[model samples]
Target: MARLAYVIKFVADMDRAVAFYSETFGFPVRMRTPFWSEVDAGETTLALHPASDANPAGSCQLGFNLDDLRAFYEKGAVTFSVPPREQHGTLLARMIDCEGAEVSLSG
Candidate 1:
């Protein structure tokens, strides 16, 4: 069976975002630097990247099963919830980067 091992991400500030996810989610840092950081999510890898100042974020929701559900949205990620007819969930949010990379965070 084939498995999706990693999902590479792009962000504005590596240090800030890395610290935020690490402190908030408690996902250990697998590999990191100024350009990218790999988050160890046990079953999956959440790779973080820094986005530029000018760019529309892409369409891609990174669904994460987290312990601290509320804190995940506290990092200024936009909340998105369908009108009951779309999906069943109490929490949903999105974070867009300058390069048009979008991450939909759910609890």
Candidate 2:
């Protein structure tokens, strides 16, 4: 059987990216270094790698399930690409992370 491991995101700024995910989504930092970092995202880990020419920021899209999408969005933590709205009978929203990656949130 195959199981998921890590979802890597190349970030322009390591500190900013770390702060964004940790503070906004409350994902605890598993490890941190100048070149790499990881956040414990439930079953899988979210890895933050320093961005370079070959691996640029905003190249990944991630989705998360929140208890209250509206309340989360209203907190003004990150800039929203799409505000919370009903789509196919589900609440969905999109927000841009510190590294410019598009992240989807649902409740």
Against the true structure, whose lDDT is highest? 2
* Candidate 2 overall lDDT versus native: 0.82
User: In candidate 1, what are the lDDT values of residues 1-107, reduced to their tens digit?
Assistant: 22444565667777877887788999998878887688897787887766654422332235444454466545445443431122354554445546555544445
Q: Which stretches of candidate 2 lie over 4 Å from their true place?
A: 61-107
Query: What is each predicted model's overall lDDT from 0 to 1?
Result: 0.58, 0.82
Clashing pairs in 2: none
lDDT of 2 by residue, 9-104 (tens): 889999999999999999999999988899998997898988877568955546677877788888897899899999969997878888886776
TM-score for predicted model 2 compared with the true structure: 0.55
Candidate 1 residues lying further than 4 Å off, grouped into runs, are: 52-107
- Taking all chains together, each candidate's TM-score versus the true structure is 0.47, 0.55
The local distance difference test score of model 1 is 0.58
- Alpha carbon lDDT at 91, candidate 2: 91
